[model samples]
Target: MPLDLSRRSLFTGAAGLTVSGLAGAGLAGCSQTAPSGTTDAAFPPGAIDPHLLGPAEGVALLSRNENPYGPSQSALDMIEYAASKGAYYANQEAAVSLMSMIAEKNGVDPEQVVLTTGSGEVLSAIAVLYGPRGPIVAPRLFWDTTALYAANLGMAEIQRVPLTDEMEIDLAAIEAAVTPDTGLVQLCNPNNPTGLVSDPATFQAAVRRMAATTTVLVDEAYIELSDDPEANSCVPLISEGHDVIVTRTFSKIYGMAGIRLGYAIASAETAAAIRPVVMSWSPCTSYAAGIGCYNDDAFIDFSKSKVTEARDMVFATLDTLGLDYLPSQTNFVYFKSGLEANAVQAAMAERLISVRGQYMDYNEWTRVSMGKVEDVERFCRALPELIEA
Candidate 1:
């Protein structure tokens, strides 16, 4: 029988489940914390410090490319409501509703959508599924989740094409690198670290050509923060039946990184092939947060404005220091630091600021995500001294 996916059925049935009864009978004994005998010191060196998981007070956190202004009031309210039924396994309904929303938003059928714990899961799934077929082709420097995961697992050979002299994704070179045996090609639009977006027409054409022979995975994790998301996205290509998978995340613009909800859009057949391999599903809170903010335009605009402001400030600082940097479309700014990337990262960490150090062979460049305006201001103030030091 087909599932009842109506909003009323979803919410009402979810609310009727007894959390206390379930928790008391089955979950009360479970613990996520360390066992009683374990201590923090028992962990090996480089284990994640729990204290560093959330925001660290007084620290300017610009390392991870996260939206600093997010989890809007609406998302928070929905999450609170969803938490009431947390003990119930609502994964099926939650996945359907979120997938329906994503499909509607992208102008695709629900069958063409595959939700994951995060976009990373889908990327990894694609890598594992296709890696055994043939080699994966990608730009030398882009968000490398799929290729790196496959290579590290000894599943696929990565064929890297260098970026252009201007440090932009060399679309032409990428197209030239594709062979009939190439199983997948990965593209990160408005790429991470560099924050450069390929020209839409050229990118689309290149993707279409590449898709004729192999599957292409476009990671649009930051596309919502770009100057024009619709124009920049390849979702329409999927609608046109291109063998392309475009993955998006609520973590960036929605400020819901902790929520862990994201998805992939593709041709129905392609989506089906990829879905079964995904290892995790998002929970109720993630579903609620995604439902609440998936179309919250006002909050999106506010987040974009603040990110632009912070990015411009970084550009100004780089200008004053006579440093070259890419004009960013995403929230982060990548700039020539004129120092070893590790040294720059260390100096900034000393000042209670966190920024990324290096990517591939770009050892002298630094990538800084847009934090709160005040924190960015602190980074701007400290940069001059750090460069001189």
Candidate 2:
């Protein structure tokens, strides 16, 4: 399909704010108690080579959200076996078996599951399959790389809808942004950076509203770590006959960030459409370690518990510091420290601490991922001073 490159009309409506951060009334504080101490690892600035501070060190506070924990034990075991057999092409049996387990787990058909190097690859696949020169609607304040993929694929018109005053997606604006050229609609749950969820009703309504023409994408990369995993997912919408595709990642919940495994769940037809778009090699055996982790009952339960504990700890710390933060259901807290997020983030780095500086969209809010219990305590103590700095 040829790419479309014309600009669409500027969205000017109550819902078209074109940004994420907004102040609203009566927001209740998190229902958790604060922590103490400085368990957070120091990324002392000027101590380590500046080149070493990659995105990981720059946003160390939100490490957990980015799969800092690495692969689970079972995943490691699988990787060992796969590496031993590295002489061969990826283990097709392992891939099929992994897909089977994923399908069974998600209550979908194996045919409906498509593995990719990472969900990022899946997103790129979506752009290729659907990006034949039309307007694609996405939130204005969204994951930095999402729109880039579409635009790279020759998407001429990129419609960016803003967050509402309450910091949720304005579905009406999304609708208004859609035009005949509209081919895809991508949305994230408990959205990236800001950490707000659209709730079930709003999600269902948005999909229902978009079903007439567009292929709706629900990116649930952080869904597993969220407060209500089941409620915040779009899997139910797929089951209810919407033209929706839901993508989940093992990187976040299974702690296999290094393995780089992610899966997409959708209607069999949609999945079929996406399969051809996926890279030929598919996911490799080394990346299949996450499959082992997903299958480990003990590890899955423990991982979920750890996430919950960290969520409470971070939220409590945010409250004690008197910082305003988006209510996060995911593993990170998106809070504004009444300071330039980058500056405070830099100061934290000087203390050998890493926090995700809100760049691009919500620069005032810094997103800190939930860490070990002790880490949570250290951040609690250091945060007040950093924010005040």
Estimate every model's Cα lDDT from 0 to 1.
Answer: 0.81, 0.67
Q: How well does candidate 1 score on lDDT at residue 378? A: 96
TM-score of each: 0.87, 0.80
Task: Compute the lDDT for candidate 1.
Answer: 0.81
lDDT of 2 by residue, 102-172 (tens): 87887877767777766766666676567664666888776636456546435434678888987778888
lDDT (Cα, 0-100) at 29 in candidate 1: 13
Evaluate model 2: give its TM-score: 0.80
Q: Model 2: C-alpha RMSD to truth?
A: 11.5
**Highest-TM-score candidate:** 1
Model 1 weakest lDDT span, ten residues long: 21-30
lDDT of 1 by residue, 20-57 (tens): 42232221112345445557676668685555455677
